[model samples]
Target: MLKKSLISVLCLSLLVPAVSLAETATHAVKPLTAHQERMKTCNADAKGKKGEERKAFMKSCLKGESAAAVKKAPEAKKHEKKTAKKPKTYKKLNSQQMRMKTCNVEAKGKKGAERKAFMKSCLSNK
Candidate 1:
């Protein structure tokens, strides 16, 4: 009975890994969603663009806008340049950056070891 149980346990251990691998393999190649397909097509079309032009092209293409319209967008932008607003004023900051900024502002008057201790405490509290 001991021999038979040990043999069965080994077989189960071997089969467990095989079954898990098969399950993972089956899930690895899922079909893309409709929106993913659209994005794929738009990305391919906008492959040559860079910076804000690429962003604008991707936005328009994903929104079901005609590629022709987006292609001629540069000319329209030329005319609108006079009325176009300035670039964004505030930058997007992550939590760590915001914490650092606040810490720096608070530690403005301090120097050397004092500033280091203040920053260390401030960073940890946040």
Candidate 2:
């Protein structure tokens, strides 16, 4: 009887990890809401814009902002303070590669093309 009980205990111990893993794997993954899905289409490239253009684009793309929202905003002078920081330098690339990278970054797609394009833009723009 003792041997049988020991075998049962060992079997239960072996099952514990599997049981926990199964439980963890069963969690429901909620899908994105409509608003979130819409926001995802907003140009990730918009981060590259600034000033009135940025405001205009964001306002139009995100829908109009309220008066109260504008009132809480910081003054324009504070926003316009430009430092004479030296421009970034980039490693020189051959023309063909540069074009490929440029096209890739700006092209709409998931994964490799998007990443390559973003990198190309960043590197070439530097």
Candidate 3:
């Protein structure tokens, strides 16, 4: 009976530490909330700033009023204007035009049958 109790106690001692360690590991790995993440970002951005500058930056950042946020409004407007402008559409060349352009490039030095054969094959491939 005494030996059994001792063995049980030993097993419990090992199990208790393992359970506590797991609990601690889980708690330690808990993800930060949105607010916490924003704060961390603001803190990093405020690294070079100090005193009133840091305080003001943190306040504006936390309030979502930083320069990036303000600049985005104008940038978004510019983007809208750019997108509002119609894109230029180009007319595709016809098969004859494409063949002429390719033949002109390929037949730069050649003449007679070679140029004719190249032009024929080039036009045929298309």
Candidate 4:
């Protein structure tokens, strides 16, 4: 009984996808026509211009007239002057400098095991 039930379930799963695919194959998709493409171009052009310039440009474009009638003004200023000072750069420690620093820190009265533990803790903290 369990074998028959499992076979039926497997058959149903296979049939469902086949039926959906067959239905989709018979349907047709419509593409966007020339008029829609022209309107998309006009909308893109009007989006960058502001207020009166935008309105005048859209009106002239829509009426099939040239863009000469639209008076284009200078773009509005959007950026602010940064008054903050630039951060200072320091020279990086070379391999020799790093070794000297490690030796100096270890020499400040720490024994071998304590020095190892301190170095491990410093690296892990970083």
Which one is best on TM-score?
1
Query: Highest lDDT: which candidate?
Result: 1
Q: lDDT of all predictions, in order shown?
A: 0.90, 0.64, 0.80, 0.67
- Model 4, position 78: C-alpha lDDT score: 16
lDDT of 4 at 36: 72
Per-prediction TM-score, please?
0.48, 0.28, 0.44, 0.32
Worst 10 residues of 2 by lDDT: 68-77
Could you give candidate 3's per-residue lDDT for residues 3-119 as a string of tens digits?
999999999999999999999999999999999998998898778777655676777787778676633554465577777978799899998997788778977897899888987
What is the lDDT for 11 in model 3?
Answer: 97
Worst 10 residues of 4 by lDDT: 72-81
Off by over 4 Å in 4: 1-29, 72-126
Q: How close is candidate 2 to the true structure, as a TM-score?
A: 0.28
Once fitted onto the true fold, the runs of candidate 1 whose alpha carbons sit more than 4 angstroms away are: 1-13, 74-126
Clashing pairs in 4: none
Better of 1 and 4 by lDDT: 1
lDDT tens digits, residues 1-126, model 2?
999999999999999999998887776466778767646654563576678655655555665455444333434434545634567999899987777667665665647876766766655663
- Which has the higher TM-score value, candidate number 2 or candidate number 4? 4
Per-residue lDDT of model 4, residues 1-126, tens digit only: 999999999999999999999888766455567767767777797887877667667666766665554433212211222444568998999876686677667657877998777766654542
lDDT of 2 at 89: 97
